[model samples]
Target: MIKAYSISLGALLLGLVLSLVFGSDLAFQRQWQLISGVEPEQFIDFAYLYSLLPRMTMALMVGASLGLVGSLMQQLTQNPLLSPLTMGTSSGAWLALVMLNLWVPLDIADLSAAAAMIGAMFAMFLVIAIVGIRNLSGLPVVLAGMAVNIVLGAVATAIILLNEQFASNLFIWGAGDLEQNDWFWPLWLAPRLLPAILIFLLAPRVLSLLKLGQQGAAARGLNVVPMFLLLSVVGVWLVAASITAVGVISFVGLISPNIARRVGARTTSNELWLSCIIGALLLVFTDLLANALSEQIGDVVHSGIAAALVGAPILIVLCQRQLRAQDQLSLSLPQSRLRWRNRYYGLAAFIIALIALLSLLGQHNAGSWSLAIPDAFNWLLRWPRWLTAVSAGAALAVAGCVLQRLSF
Candidate 1:
């Protein structure tokens, strides 16, 4: 435990120093006199120093809060699948932004964070309702999240189609850019998050108790319902704030905890601290990559892709043959009741309908709609959007059903 704490503390301090050094260097480089012989303290002018200080503080607090939330979420859901993005909160936040844009026409630059928070909370509410207190699990929440995400994504797409002027801006934001001017974001997040962090710290044993099955927790005299709800609210708030500030960076919550566990943090407290360190390092490193690579690759490569880069290989390893074998032996699986009656015929009909739509609406932006239909159809099966959506939905549904059966 001491070793873990020391490692985490070391990483945290190191990240802070690097953040300050890099941030100051960038500010200095922007000016020629500072490049030559200006004092380092001159680079840290009142305005520059203030801006740098607040943003750095924001990053640390936000990262730590996000890490804590991820830890609690993984433990509560008992699945590594749950995360702010995967669980649909980020989509919900985007949906809110779309609605705000359509309805209010207020300055998005001013209201982005507020809109994000409301949207994230709304998404969390939907997930909680679908999973219910009795049926709560990582998988059901993920399915509900994906459904919300798809519907919201479709809506956002429609908005973009109608308002082409905003398309580029929305696209940029959607891809998870953490660059912001607000020195107040950390201040906004810190006060709200600090109470929960304190509660978590004081009740370390409670987290371990909660990690046990509901029955085990109850047997230990824990108030499972209220405590669970409280933790979820804190987790959601932490995620919402981070997403609001950083945009929808996928897999930070999902991958950080797993990495923490892999590094020898087994118990809840250890995992929580390690996750904070890992999450901070991840965001800093990814932000570095974003700054360094943006000139080469253009702005299309986002910080969120860092999670995929880091997490994808780890996910495969986590699902290796040995793990599968252990799961097969130790777990008695539930039979799946898939509703497959006229689905395939319906699917074929839909494909034909899509073809017809393409025939009618072809040639909007580019090539002949008629020619594009076949290409699109052929490509549809291989399309990342379609394939990921369907696979994620089906897998989450089955997993949810299985978990509900086993837990019940």
Candidate 2:
């Protein structure tokens, strides 16, 4: 526990130093003095004081809130895959804002929080309704969440596409920019996040009771529904507020608790606290990377995209390292008695290798295809496409095999 916490704190401190160095020319002492209440002498100092500091504070608060909420939800459902993203909060909030901007004449900037919170709550219920209250601790809920996200995300995307001019302001926010102009957002968000205290005080005990199993807890005279509902509502509120403040950053909540578990956080409270620290560290570094890349490429890079890029691979690796049998599938597949043969494997390998070879070397000119090694120019331009096709196909095939194996 000490080692895990030490690592988390070290990473956080390193991230803070890197964040300070990311886009600022100020020396470390000057930056420290500015943050320590020294007066800003120039625009650069003011930028660091307001923009970077508030942005960092927002990142920590939002990330910690997400981590705590995620831990709470996962413990409630006993489902590691549960998070605000999976529960349709992000998409739901996004869709509400989209519709608000589409119809309401008032500034969406002011109305976004209320709309998003409503949408997030509605989406959570929509998921719960689809899966049923009794079936929350299972794959059914996750599938239900996917269905909600797809439908709502599609609707929001279609609206944006159809009315691009009107919804232009929503694009950057949707990408989850952490850029701040001043302390307004930090001050606004800090008060809303105070309910996290309630979560910390109430969650561990309820979650511990829940660990006793629903039937066992009921037998012991515990009313599970009200407690569960309270936690779920608070969790949803935290997530909605988070995305509302920073747009649609995801995966932090989904991955943090898992990392906490991997690092040996056995108790609910320990997991929640550790996940909070890890989540804050993850976002601070991710934001630093985003800002660094923007400087290098001379174009803006949103923290949301950076989080997805970093977190997706980590999630995949986690999935592989811990491929346990989760909640049963809502639907069943037809059982097949047939077994794979060595010849079948050989045939599949040959076909994949042949296609990959041809894809790498084959060129089409004058409406004809021929297999020949491409020049450096062509290879450089097309390798990503080629790699993506070959790798994606193999990945899908492997995933299908794994799904079949796991399902059966």
Indicate which candidate wins on lDDT: 2
lDDT to native, each model? 0.67, 0.85
lDDT of 1 by residue, 185-261 (tens): 66666666666565467446777887778899899999987887777766776776676666667666767787788
| RMSD of each candidate relative to the true structure | 7.9, 8.7
User: What is the TM-score (0 to 1) of candidate 1?
Assistant: 0.69
Kindly give the stretch of ten consecutive residues in candidate 2 with the minimal lDDT sum. Answer: 321-330
Name the lDDT value of residue 312 in candidate 1. 59
- lDDT value, residue 85 of candidate 2: 80
TM-score of each: 0.69, 0.79
Give the TM-score comparing model 2 with the true structure, all chains together.
0.79
**lDDT per residue (tens digit) for residues 57-96 in model 2:** 9889888888888888889988888888878888999888
